[model samples]
Target: MAKSAKTKTEVVAETPVPKKTRKKTEPVEDLTIAEAPIQLQAVENYSRFSEFDIYLFKSGKHFKLYEKLGSHVAEYKGVIGTYFAVWAPNAHYVSVIGNFNGWERGSHPLSSRWDGSGIWEGFVPNIGRGEVYKYFIKSMNNGLELEKSDPFALWCEVAPQTASVVWDTWYEWQDEGWMRNRRKHNSLTSPISVYEVHLASWMRDPDNPERFLNYREIADSLVPYVKEMGFTHVELMPIMEAPYPPSWGYQITGYFSCASRMGNPQDLMYLIERLHLEDIGVYMDWVPSHFPGDAHGLYNFDGTHLYEHADPRKGYHPDWKSYIFNYGRNEVRSFLVSNAVFWMDRYHTDGLRVDAVASMLYLDYSRKHGEWIPNEFGGRENLEAISLMKEMNEAVFKDFPDAQTIAEESTAFPGVSRPTYLGGLGFGMKWMMGWMNDTLKYFEKDPMFRRWHQDQITFSLVYAFSENFMLPLSHDEVVYGKGSLIGKMPGDEWQRFANLRLLFTYMYTHPGTKLLFMGGEFAQAREWNFQQSLDWHLLNQAPHKGIQECVKALNSALRNQPALHDYNFSPEGFEWIDSQDRDNCIVAYSRKGLNPSDTIVVVLNMTPVPQQGYRIGVPSVGIWEEVFNSDNPSFYGSGVSNTQVIETQPEKWHNQPQSVVLTLPPLAGIILKKSAK
Candidate 1:
């Protein structure tokens, strides 16, 4: 219920707080009004925007809109009040509404900027931190009235309560060391073992299964576990505020606000700060492709489809039943780009993994013929989206040189991870979806049939270095009736775990960065359910413990072994030693670094039968020892390993000058490193 009557605007001025007493997080509501009050119109004498800001915002170059557009707590003319700004050009009238004003629409109307930027702004006294509010907009078109959440809100009320909150980003960050030297950790050449997690489901209140652990609680548990597990970075699933938990944070309503269900903005910052302190980088999953069509969200914003396209073909997403963004619009581009930059700028995120990129790149993605409109050039490419992506990437890298942008692009779009100056999309990395699909397909088959389909495993190297790639066994593979990674294997319990270990070893040794979904590391038996926590009880079993230990070892090897990561994205870093061993259901390769002494050989045995005295080619004539064997007893593997270091012979095997004879364990992968000459 709201008051329908319009009221004349008014503002009250009071003595300013001492500069020394002012703090960003100080609640403005605590201030006492002066006895002799000075009253003025609510929309008069206060503005946070400058002429240049309007110019940039109009021309779509304003990437830091978070500073200009959101509701910011400020002291105006010696009085503490909140400054509100929103872009709703189609609205004839816009007013602030919330509990503070008794949901009165016309009591606090904002004035349009004189610069024709379509930005409505004003200052309201006594509206301070923690006040819930929404824009009550009367659209010029058909006098349509809408109550919409602020797109640039720094915080929002929890789900089932959609009003935006007046808040500030103030946190004492203790991650200076991490921020100063993050380049090395987030470098393309570094060993980036990302553990992708859905925060709500990663772990919950053990005492109450229905409750989600807040950001601080998650930090206490997740930080140490990831540190001990040896992952270099943590890629959190979309954390933006979404009304429905089933959407899993993807259907973002508050683009700039962290999900209120988790905690406030500072709470999330604390979690990220703790991670950085632990030397772990954070990657946020960003979704600029489509948004859920909620009434209070961007859809039909201002009752004019302001944030989305006017046409159904270009504006709607068929697959996800969401509304696509109007990338062609300048203001929308500025809003989207600003949202991307805000995370890195304010949240100190190390990277952005752009989600559903392929869906954004093509004009007819998931649509049949005649259902999509071609670009002006009569091409199927989404030219506007392409341009927006380039601008977004340029802004992200230009502002934060150490940060990276990774694309979850499935199609063969050229130069997705290349530089924008070279007609590329300018991402630092792209997920290798082909590799994940092929590897999983090969592993799910009976070992006897794998030899016939050797190309399924070897096909990835054909384009491994085409663009910077990250092999991802993500959560998508284990949801919606899809079985768990372990359950995907075709074998008894022991063999299934063995296959998962071998799969992980292959991924780490492969020529790319690595990403593993939460439950995959330990082989959680059931499919992922966003509603419940992972089966932590599964760790009590020996096999599950074995898989977890195997992943830890793989991460260690990926980090410590230079040969595995130094040239991971370069052809010079890899060589095929025995790809034609289809008869033996085995594939072997060598990894090289700057120094020849840093070379390592990897061999994978796909079958259950051990190969006694298997001869694999070596790059150098020296003593080579089994540095890591997946079949070790520690990982619950059948105890089979080459305990002795062997000197290579001038055997001219597999086109190499020298070779070594070693015992290959059944259904396992092993790493060999040459000893110092």
Candidate 2:
């Protein structure tokens, strides 16, 4: 038993270790060679793939089709050219047009494959990097033509420009030492304190205040902030190519391309490389549940619901006003799975936080009685989407076992983090949305009434270990009149600070990994506005400064201690000393690690009145040292704290062999551990 207390795999070569040169695999089709006039010389070496790819793609298992289906620059025969291809099974004709070809659809037409594979390919000589391109596709169903950006583009023209750029994703990584040993830092036993950030709003030019920081600039700034704050990883909101700024990168148009709002694709690589070098794993929000209905995007591609469901009830997302992916389609599955792998393969991301998983798992999520169509089994479960999720998770773990797949699932979807073979979703972890909701709601109420809601605080332990979980105080909690973390507390400024500090202290001691959105660390006064930066000036205020100081101190303890994090997923790591102390609005627990001596006692007092003689059980008989006190003066507290050391009594208490009478500060928490000898 970890006197218990309590969190970032398998593909070896497929892990995408960077190298100076890559070996050519197979020849991809070249439409110029097949459709060009006899006098027009074709770039023969432009054949970047083989019929084997078509065979694999046909079966929907082609995970690297991005290598063949997008515009890529390479040497075919003797001439260097940009090879272009797209999956338009229902297109009558697909042409590659851009500034390189004078935007004339007829200038560089693609040749359809003879095997009825629905893929069109061609190569344009003299075209190279930095050139903008888009596919002019003629819909086979409606005979209507549409211009669409490459879904597999590595980079794109910064919004509001909707053009794909012929770019390369070659970055010389220097985090080799970090990548090779990431398993140690990302494992279940390791502490995972994630700092969720929105690149656009995390910070901005103080002088200009309007210009967004570039990826490199953020590396120089945000990277160090996270490192100094003792975060183990940085989970970014969707940085994928998105046009709408207010959507906050959630409604994505390009899965493969990083949002051009920040920088080019290589710039994203630089950002990831920087975070890795700092020993911080990088995780990005990946939205596979639904896509926007933008005309330039996947909606009605080829003049039909090619990427979405044919039925509106099954295809549309009423909540986000978007279109859902047709996960049942083999080609769509391949597209999504390959995109998931592409990040790990090309950008070296540590994990993906799958967004809107609840919507994907349930066909009737956020839908009224008749707004949804049931599956073939006549149930609420989305069978096709469930299959795709399993397959995606399987591929991700198979290719990179150490890499993580986290589901933002809110339902009682059993076994979300369990392996697929075990009849689960195969995710590495699931967001603890229930815990967040319950706990936050409990804390928001007045402490006088907290006794009536003790179940909210103690109920989490009932199923805390059912799935590997991440406790997230995310941006969703403090946006659009939801108020800031501190604002939710019901009291004067001082009590608010105390409650927020106590809340964070409890979160760190609880089971599961940790994730905190930006601004919550310092208790930013205003709700998060995606349009502007955080009120960083608040750091100068004593109360707000105290909150930040409390976070830093709490993070220090969370990082240095083993008992607090080593066994978070198992019941052995955590034991309730007095969970039924609802009358006093207090709870006591012990966190244990693998080593017998690695034990920490935690006591929380939620009321305004301090408990001077709070007797709590201790697993060890010795002098229990006060290692941390959230009520210390440095944290903007009233200086109410216990002496450094207090010896345990021999009398039994709370059903323990040993006990200690300690002063529990009002609206605060304290951590104690056995001193040496």
Candidate 3:
């Protein structure tokens, strides 16, 4: 029940009209009176402007205003002493409590004066750097007591008892044009395979479980492995400072600081610098959707709801049990936008993979059936959050055009990776979740059931064309009860090993850029556990050693093949040749470049039965040589199939000009390159 009314304004002034007499009507033109300056009529106070109109104004005028405000804020940069501000509409008094005051509450009360609005401002003189503090607010309405930290704190440090640390220091980046060069060389699918690894669990010295390798140790050891593996990028899973152990770095406590537990800030920068020097791109997992629940963290900072919404319904996430940010607020938006810029500008990181974007896009995202409310228009979308995300993307692209921002959204939200100008979420790329799920489901089925599921592999192309996608074997699918990729096979040990080889070969040959999680290449025997180290000894074992060799070979082949890299970004790059026989477990596909001369055909057999003289169609009529084979004796395979050097017959099968005959073996894959056209 909202009320609406309009009020009319009276004329304030009248202009004197001059009386004119026209003799004989010289060119008698009818003069119409101009509308009276569209009189200052008041519309209903309850009525608000349209969201698009507001956005237009904000994007133009408000941004200019913020630029002016930023200039004002910049004037105090590096000037010592403490300048503090708080927003507590419901609180009467707010005091600064911290180590600076010997942890006393009343010793150094923040002298805050309320503007007519809820905001309270104060400045504490000579409160130098590295001081930890929280706010003590007295609730006016309920007389409740509350303690909070600064929501916009650039740095916070409290020992073992407190979770955050002060990390406000300057970084000097020497790689001035490295980002530009990287973007120019790398595309959505330019052989840009990524090795996704969690730094803490990736390596642990046998002598120390509590004491893991620092950033320097990781860079020295892991970078060589990544370089040898031939992955273009290294995606770290949430390097931001967090509190919980075994939490996979998702519950971030410090938004602007690197995880201090790993190493010092300089060490993290050194890692990034080393990676850049090695010509490997680094992508950070950025989680701006939510913050941790720790009292010392972002929650209730500044003795009020500064970062998050004041309303619990809007602030709390149901499933994760975390606090969501109020993106509707301008300061919050600026903070996040600046954070993104800070990482790229300071660290020289090439890209970001934004985590849990679906959680940020909807109001009722993870809520139970009856616990959520819709907008006034009866839609469940959180338009304000969407707008903020869009603005953030726009800001990132404008500031750092070379840096990519990838989305980790699982929902079927259209255009999550589309350009912002196209009325979509502006992500450079998005995880191909549907393709991964469908492919995994197809792979998990028995050979007999695979015929019906074969379409799953081919049919994904329909939606895959919509956005740039990464074929990710992310950390999510490997850890916990989900089991490792090798553990998901449907056969004996040898068959399982062969199935994994087939899977990897297919993955390497797939159109999208691939991401293989740590220990996946070596075929770790058990599922991944965050608490324990990856089975490093597996590299010594013969079976696992063979898998690693195959991985290396596959990575090498992917890098060398022109067809694989040239047109790998487009729908036309991939063509399914055969999926007809499920019992025999044979699937064949081909990749072709924009130049017809560059072409490659791959055939895989997952069945126990070996067949001689198997004919598979090729995309070109030319001599086809075996470029790679997963069943080679060096890879610990049975080597039942002949190492055939076949020539394609002059035939146009399935619109292609070639067909090659080869011997096919159980649990093997063969990659063939057409002879030079």
Candidate topping lDDT: 1
Over the stretch 330-422, how does candidate 3's per-residue lDDT look in tens digits? Answer: 656766776776677667878889999998888889787667767668888888888877877887788778778888888888888788999
Q: Give the winner by TM-score: 2 or 3.
A: 2
Which parts of model 3 have CA positions greater than 4 angstroms off? 1-97, 107-159, 310-313, 640-642
Minimal lDDT window, size 10, model 2: 1-10
TM-score of each: 0.94, 0.93, 0.83
Off by over 4 Å in 1: 1-45
Q: 426-509, model 1: which lDDT tens digit per residue?
A: 999999999999999999999989999999999999999999999999999999988999999878888998898899999999
Order of all candidates by TM-score, from best down to worst?
1, 2, 3
Question: Residues 1-677, candidate 2, lDDT per residue (tens digit)?
Answer: 01110000011112232212112222222223333222222444355557788788887898987777888776666777788878888887677878765677666667666666777777788877777888888787787778898888877777777878877676777889888999887888888989999999989989978999989888999888888888899999999999999999999988888888777776788899989998999999999999998877888877789889989898999999999999898888899999999999888999999999999999999999999998898999999999999999999989987788889999899999998999999999999999999999999999999999999999999999999999999999998799889889989989999999999999999989999999999999888999898899999999889988888888888888899888969898999999998899999999998887889999999998998877888887999888888888899988778874689999898888999999989999999999887
Model 1: pairs clashing at backbone N, Cα or C within 3 Å: 10-42
Estimate the TM-score for candidate 1.
0.94
lDDT of 2: 0.85
Model 3 lowest lDDT segment of ten: 4-13
